[model samples]
Target: MVTGVEAPLAVTRVGVVGLGLIGGSVARTLVAAGVDVVATDPDGATRAQAWDAGVRTVGSAAEVLVERPDVLVLAPPLAALPAVLAELAAELPRLVADGGPLPVLTDVGSVKAPVRAAARVAGLEDRYVGAHPMAGTEESGFAASRDDLLPGCTWAVTVAPTTAAGDLLRVLALIAGPLRGVARVVEDATHDAAVALVSHVPHVLATELLNLTTAAPARALALGLAAGSFRDGTRVARTDPRRTQAMVAGNADAVVGALRDATRHLDALADALEGGDDAAVTAFFDAADPVRAALAEAAAGDASPRTETVALGEPGWRERLVSLGAAGAVVARTGRDAITLAVPPPSPK
Candidate 1:
């Protein structure tokens, strides 16, 4: 069972695969916090860099299982999951032959259900948990990684019907405990759908925004006049296009729904402006005031946190955590029989 203590983190050692921005950051950040960390990347230079930063290096994904980390966090790109998952499975026998239990399996993947499916294929789903730190940059590779990325970020840690409460709490202990972060215990589908609305579709729209600027007849003038708003809106388009493509493709179904919703909203706003319906325009903007306020509060980092209890000793615990996450509550501590949940202030409607 996990305790409610904070700082110096509960997870003492973590093993990571793929030393790209997210994985590299995870290894770097945990090492900075005095963790005994081991990680691997295909790029030798990346492994050397992680070693320079005080992280132990492994030669390959299968070797990570040999190290027998308490938790194995695979941080590969969306397209690379299949290969790494296979690697982990191939090493499972070697790991267990030594009379050691498999490490808690998790990943930093943006999409969830597919990862779970892949884990099942590898026969590793029994120990698999899914987690996504709601933080990243328009950058790729270890060179662009930083230790500061995950601190205070809300991790969308996932739960499934078959998940053991203890397994869920182990991942929570790492994110919410020593790492000093908060997390939502969400269902995989729920996480995919919500992130599509907030992340994937926005990436698409931002890329489109950048594309529009390039095609404009006044391109040079507009480029010269581009200000903070334009930069802020389109910054993600600056990410490696292939990486962005993989991310959006990984969550295509939800992204399609969100994209159509965006289209419908744009169509309505255009109709209102064309008809000169000032009232309709006013109502349209008013309808999103709450979303605007919520985003503002989050950006400002001013929403104070308060606590509520989530019972973990009872049946339907997975469902309970899912409901709390949907309500925007985060697990602050997973105690012996309950989770101390930190609920942020309600967004104004």
Candidate 2:
């Protein structure tokens, strides 16, 4: 319903290449918007869940390629991004490039620099934009997918100078409609560094904290007693190891730098505790309290909800995704109707 220049184009067909938490959420949101969604995943059961959720599923990227969707969202792990681009390049050169050729392509990869580099190398840079939706739960996988996950999160949209304005607008529309968050335009490097600071580095710190608890004699008891604060502090540490590791590994330098800064902050906190400086401790809390308050306020204000509609071209892909059993059926509706898709529950894994 949010009108834009591309409103005339009307996103009829959207192809999602993954059925993980992020990908499944995207499809569900699009379906709620009345857009026909075709999706594929390597996991068979995942595809079935997606179908139940109402999205059409396809067997492979090749099948999606043949469908020639209006937009292709590459929602894969950071490490798999390059290979996915390669696969797309080999499988659907002409179709993707049709209409003078080239469909608008975007990705939901957390890391940007490497993805951009890989796309550039693969010669898909022109149509591709690097995007990161800064919202996630401690859970993952298709079962965890939820349309509302994106609505109030920051979604970074990175583009090179060569990216077309129309294409950029279309990408923004897709992200903004579902996320209801700011479509921040940042350079790839800046996006990577920022995510490293706010996301990747925190996950590392949380993991370390959790590890300390694991070695304690009363670990089981401690875990049992763990309540809201402990859960909040260590939530990210509970995300899928493979996904978190890949993100950290991909953005190594920035994460390391952030960790160094965090260490310095921790050292100062330790000094205050050792010195028994009540004033310093109070000051620390004073400073942190306001920051946290402001962040919460900002997040609340920025994560407003909106409805998005997406149109579909064919039924094959939707049927295939439904069969994966990753999530549930997505139906067309207006005004926040698509926000209820199943979200993966948080697991120790």
Candidate 3:
């Protein structure tokens, strides 16, 4: 049985399909936790990397399922999830028909509604869980994988309506135990909406910012004048285009809504400045000051292993918590009216 998380069963072998940044890290972390990991990647370099790291390598995701690991983590790109789940759905019952145990399957995808829907359509709803790790650098591929990548990160887990409690707890055990991440359960649609605003839209905005400056006649001059602020804002523009496109496409409505809201805010700021409304301008910048402080305060709390819950309200709490560097502060669950944040406790001296 898993210890701290109190899972009903022990997970000794984990199968990881796809050895990109998230998958590679899962392989590395499971190995470090003394769990045998069987992984597959189409890329020879990534398969070799996993083999070198002591994880058993396989040729394809189908092979990983044939092995029937205790748990299988699907870590492929967002666009690839549907087909993969369908394949797994077909493969799983065959594996279990022979009286062999069926492994619990989970995916580390950014958007959830599409994946969950795919799983439902494939008749794999009970065995599948949707998860997103709110962690990663601006880098991709196996070379960027690190065991420490997930520590203190919020691993958002979304359980479909038909998911079994045992399956849910097992995923939680894996996330909280080996990964050293805080596991929080959220619904599928809520997960999609939350990520669209915070991650997907920001990535699109960064790409647009880069495009705006580069397409201008003064491009060379504009780039030369760019400073830390500009570089920081445009950092995610470096993300893999295919992956970003998949995210945008999967959550198109939410992305468009977020972008519209952002446009309105920008217009309000412009109107305030153009009209020479000193009070309005001051209020605009001043409103963001608390968010910055909230972030700093949250960051200071991450040195410890405790958690604090904050009821998400009125739009600025996420900015404050994220700014504080408390990666543990995440949307644990969302209700009709508000979200519940799992804030990490302050560190000890």
Candidate maximizing TM-score: 1
Candidate 2: count of backbone clashes, pairs at least 3 residues apart or interchain? 44
lDDT string for model 3 (114-184, tens) is: 77888788888878888889986467888889888976777778865476655665676678767767666
Model 2: ten consecutive residues of lowest lDDT: 334-343
Write candidate 2's Cα lDDT for 92-147 as tens digits. 65663564445578888888888888888878898887788877746789998988
Find the candidate with the highest lDDT and give its number: 1
List clashing residue pairs in candidate 3: 295-320, 295-323, 295-324, 296-324, 299-324, 301-346
Q: Count the backbone clashes (under 3 Å) in each candidate.
A: 1, 44, 6
Candidate 2 ranges with C-alpha deviation above 4 Å:
1-9, 96-101, 178-182, 217-228, 275-293, 296-349
RMSD to truth, every model? 2.9, 11.1, 7.3
Q: Model 3 — which ten-residue stretch has the worst lDDT?
A: 1-10
Off by over 4 Å in 3: 1-9, 302-349
Per-model TM against the reference: 0.91, 0.74, 0.80
Q: Lowest-scoring 10 consecutive residues by lDDT in candidate 1?
A: 1-10
User: All models: lDDT?
Assistant: 0.83, 0.70, 0.75
Model 1 bad stretches (over 4 Å): 1-10, 295-306
- Tell me the deviation in Å of residue 286 in model 3: 3.4
